[model samples]
Target: MQAIAERSPLLSKYETFERGLPSHPESIKHLRRQGKDSFEANGLPTTRQEEWRKTNVAAIGRTSFERVSQDTNSLSHEQIRSFLLPDCIDLVFINGRFSHKHSQLEDLPKDIFAGSLANALVQKPELVEAHLGQYADLGHPFVALNSAFIEDGAFIHVPSGVTVEKTIHVLFLATARDGTPTVSYPRNLFVAEESSQVTVVESYGGFRDDRYFTCPVTEIVGLANSVIDHYRLGQESLGAFHVATQKVYLSRDANFFTHSINHGGALVRNDIQALLDAEGIHCTLNGLYLARGSQHVDHQMRVDHAKPNCHSYELFKGILEDRARAVFNGRIYVHQDAQKTDAKQSNRNLLLSKGALVYSNPQLEIFADDVRCTHGSTTGHLDDEAIFYLRSRGIGEEAARSLLTYSFAGEVLDEIRLEAVRKEFEEFLFTRLPKGDIVRQAV
Candidate 1:
């Protein structure tokens, strides 16, 4: 592994990053060192590996992305207002560092602790140490890299028996500085205690045409009887690269729901894993991705039913056009003790052009005899009959195509519990489609 570490271009950057770090508790320092060692041992994944065969990340390993500083920049509230949600508390982070000026956290509840993870480390190190680096897999290179550079991000803790009425929005914005391609590692931890309820929104975006890299890892823990609703919106710049991982842990009788929507990024990959650690857990995972003009998007999902009497469902849809490509790999694993487990996984894709490509794979691994598991995948072009039907009903060809595309992507959007977030994405979709004005008017 020392040989591999010597060959990596990021080795020097890691050295620089380590030397500049502030002193911390032995636990965190040990975790960072462990991550550095793990990353050096495994290195960045390549297409030669089965897990990354469909997606190539050679460019990421070849590029040099400088780490961003925590100093406040010139970004203003008005510039990021569009990404803010109504009737919610917003915590803003610029290049992975929390910005108190742009954040609207005044309305945060008294019982809830929603703020920067770095702040939490200083003020409440015990709480931060309990859950940090506990759930996400360290074997993965990206996760290890994020762990090695995990300085700041959102940290939300909901105490027992408390319900947050308003949504908690955490926004991460990336901007290029001095023409230097930058990279940020945003690590977030959301812990919902027993019988508590909360809704969290994680949004990532950047300036259009900016070249950068964003590697983020989020861990969500739902205790017994807790309810957690999460939404992750990825709208990075078209020229940027994004690799993210999300790990979810559900206890007995806990309910966890998540929606992942991706609309931008030159190269994007999302890795999600959910663990049903106890009985009577209900988990739902939904995702939507739109790609066009040579963009590449990939989603790798796994649901592990480790206990009995657990239910999990996954549905992911993608739309590709103009030489765009997408990959969806979803798997369900039911352990030997997980009897009476019910799990379903589905992946569907629509190709709007002949050059567009999609690779869909849905798998199920069940060790329990009495478990019920099903998986399916479908990929094809738009329905000619449906388009013709709309065209015959007085809609133009472009408008008809736009309407069908909108309808195809609407399935996952409808699953969003936040009305404001749903509408914002709808408007974004309207602007992205051809003859969007006509479709918006007709709808």
Candidate 2:
């Protein structure tokens, strides 16, 4: 414990942060206290732990990051225009606090509440109190840290029987501060009531060449017969560290789909878990990550089938170049009562250089005898035969390689139902490839 305290400065800084916090409701205060206690006990995880054996976060533990108390409104609309998607309801947050000046909420449907979590705590305390800090587990140190500083983020609620035609986009922007490295905890809660349908996109981005820390936690609840499509896009600074956790709970007959796209960050870790609590639930999780330089990206995923007659699918792919490294651990758990549960998980990796490394593990823990569950993982370089075949078709070597890489990544991108989001990713891919114009023209 003393060693952990010596390594992590946040333990001491947390006391000051709690003392200076503004007055909140009793329930919220209790939640913060719980978070503080959990973090104090666990501190930060280390390589000795099984779950974190491969990913080391010693740099994050050693840094003394400044926690901003208020939002920074220094950005103009033009500064963030490039990050915004077309034909969507946009909600922007700067340094973890919502920016009303830049958000567009006029098109929100009736009976649907979409805005800042901090404002919702004041305007609709009951609704905020009911679901806040309910699903996300505090055992993880980062989740506890985010819970300890739960102040502002996106809050979206779709009432019963309402279908949201437009996509709700929540953008979190992190800017660099002068003195010390900064940190922000953005806590989001998304609740879809019974028989409702909605699509949400959560995007994280930072200024170029910035060094900062972003620890965010998002909790999603899908009521009976609800249909939800969620997209989490991470485009942090190449020198930044990002650790995020997303917890999802789906009731009977609920349909849920999520896609995680990671393209930036020096050190990134994503933990996503979904719980199917009742029968007849369908859940899908898909992810794509691209890493280069010395960047490290880790993804940990879990799907719990607690009830019978549920189906879940998971597919994650990674492209690594230079000395970049990545890790993917996916687990599907089936309870004894979860009979007739069908689950499939796959993780694939493409290594662009000899120094690039990947550790992919797909697991299944099934207690039910009458169930079908399959998992597989593959890690290798781009197929030389395929590249040669493409080169023989009058394509340049660089363009052929880029085109094959695009084709490998397109498998996951093609699953995106939103045309605007898909196009945005496609453009991003073109910009990152060598001889991008040729690849774009060939594709």
Candidate 3:
């Protein structure tokens, strides 16, 4: 491990990085040590690696980014007002640290606990210590980097037989006044006990026009018969780099659903994995990404059917224009003992420009003969016939193209259960598309 770390220029400053963070409890310290050691062994991934073959991160590796200072709190409320959700419990983070003034945590139920992870470690050490680093895949370099600097993020726990009617929103904002490229590692933990139901929305957005980096990790656990719905929205600055990982585990008869929407960033990579640990579990994953003007977005999904009579489904779509690049790798695995497993995966991409490119791969590994598993991927340009048809109906060329593109991406957006969120996303997409003015005016 030391040999690998010594060869990389970016990792040579690991000791300095470790010294910057504040002190933590022994358990957390030990966990961070493990994470650092794991990072030392693997280092940053390269295109030579199978998982990272299509995505090259050499630019991010060569650049050095400063960690956000603990006392820095210059972000104004108005700066983040546009990104906030109305009438929901919002937990805000500035430069990776929890902001009490910006967050709303009062008037909560007696048995529920929802607040900062850093505070949870102090007030409820045992509760946090038990599940902080339990589900993450430490082998991944980005995950290890996040774990090594696990300082602050959102934390939520719902007890058995408790149902929270309102949604919980966790927002992370990145800003640097000195114009230095900064990095933030935000970790979130969510646990839903038996017979409980909860919905959570996690969002990352840039408040300032700064070239920064954000690497976040989220872990979710669903106990027996629990229902959990999760959504992640990433809208970083054009000069910013973003990478994230999400790990989920579900118990018997648990129902879980996750939707990931990525819209901004210079280079972005997302890895999402789920484990159906017990029988009769149902899991669904849906994702959408929009890339343009040389931007890059990559998504990797893996779902393991470890128990029998479990079902899993995944759908990911992308819209790329100009010289933008995108990647989608979806893998589903059914164990030998999981005889009744039902899994399906699909990846579709729509290219709007000749220079735009996409790599879509869908794979399945089934050891059980009785399992029903299918996977497919498609990458192509917009339908010329459809565009012509719309144009003949009095719509301009640009408007026709924009309408078709909107309809293609709207499939995943329409699946969103929240009316407010769905409407907001529709407006956001209409504003970003080519000839977006036409779409916006029509809407």
Candidate 4:
């Protein structure tokens, strides 16, 4: 069955696109061919696979989604403006193609680089070639697919000792002006040099209610003493399928922080991997997922402590309503040479209905005896005592359940350093909180 799915028409269409995908300097072409080969060999993960046991993407394989086109004139600027971050350099992509008209690149520092990856390959091929396809795990089919079809996405470069006062926002808007189910591969590459500081926001959204597939891959490199605040927001339409892979590489004394908020899509999965390649690295990964009405959301993370004196922390929270399903898999690995490594991971889920389900697995693999590493996972109904206490304080039952649920997910939101983004998530979370009927019986 898995083999049949791999050979499905959807993959064939992807292969066609892969063959014709643009390539320049010949090396990128070679990388594209490599991506195609790897994807074909590995194929989509099956439920039988350990990493994909709880989440099945057979439906995605069965759906015949067309390749996303470059035409985005149907979407108005006003429609995409709401998704942009305030006081930030916004790089907008429509249907996997960069939009100069909708993007704001003015007044940027002279040396800093922020623009489309395709353009970067043409103008600054040397810098992009050094790290284009280096960090993405070719083992992952989605990553391979994105690599194979890599075209236009955000490309940002900050030199040493430079601090970007404003955040860099990369927004991808998926639209089906022709009313067809489409698929887009959005690839982003970020490089922060030594002692540089910056904040980046990656947002994937839809301009219409059309069914689409958004497969995006982001690779980040943080040099020594660099500080990076990264945020990913997945808010696709209800009929969309979204899968993304984010890989972060850190050097000595580098600090990298990530926060992911997933609130939309019919089937969504996020793979976040942070590599502490040098000593004295500080890494934090936090996520919040809200799903309902048969939606499926999954977040998988891996933090690798490759050197001594590194610290990593991970926390992921989820709220599921109706018949929604969620999966959280987090692993912290301390290498043999990673002495004095301190790592902690926790995953908590709140189910608002009996039909809602969650599968959580948090694991710690420590090879160094001197390291402090621990992981914890919990999945259950909302706290009854807290709900009862709120009810006893004269709050209505629905309001009480909502409050507790919000509090449960708020912990992860507090980690977002950007106040505007935090407030936006708060509004979206409140609006998505199961109203009346769904909230009445959570406790």
lDDT of 3 by residue, 229-265 (tens): 8888888888878989999989999999989999888
Candidate 1 lDDT tens digits, 1-443: 33334656665667777777766677888888888889888889999998899999999998988777865455877778877889889989998999988888888988789999988888888888999999999999899989888889999999999999989999999987878888899999999999999999999998887889999999999999999999999999998899999999999999999999998899999999999999999999999999999899999999999999999989899999999999998989999999999999989999999999998988888899998898889998788999999999999998899999999988888888889889888899889988999878877
What would the per-residue lDDT of candidate 2 be over residues 142-237, giving only the tens digit for each residue? 998889888889999999999999999999988878846788999999999999999999999987868889999999999999999999999999
State which candidate, 2 or 3, has the greater TM-score: 2
Give each model's whole-structure lDDT. Answer: 0.90, 0.91, 0.86, 0.86
Q: Residue 327 CA error for candidate 2 (Å)? A: 0.4
**Lowest lDDT block of 10, candidate 2:** 1-10
Cα lDDT tens digits, model 4, 255-350, are 999899988898899999989999999999988898989999989898989999999998899889999999998988889999999999999998
Query: In terms of lDDT, which candidate is strongest?
Result: 2
lDDT of 4: 0.86
For candidate 3, what is the TM-score? 0.95
Clash totals, every prediction: 0, 0, 0, 0
> Of the candidates numbered 1 and 4, which has the greater TM-score value?
1
Ranking by lDDT: 2, 1, 3, 4
Model 4 CA deviation exceeding 4 Å by range: 1-23, 207-209, 434-443
TM-scores, each model vs. reference: 0.97, 0.97, 0.95, 0.94
Q: How much is 395 displaced in model 2, in angstroms? A: 0.3
RMSD of 3: 2.2
- Which residue ranges in model 2 land beyond 4 Å of their true spot? 1-7
For residue 81, model 1's alpha carbon misses the true position, in angstroms, by: 1.6
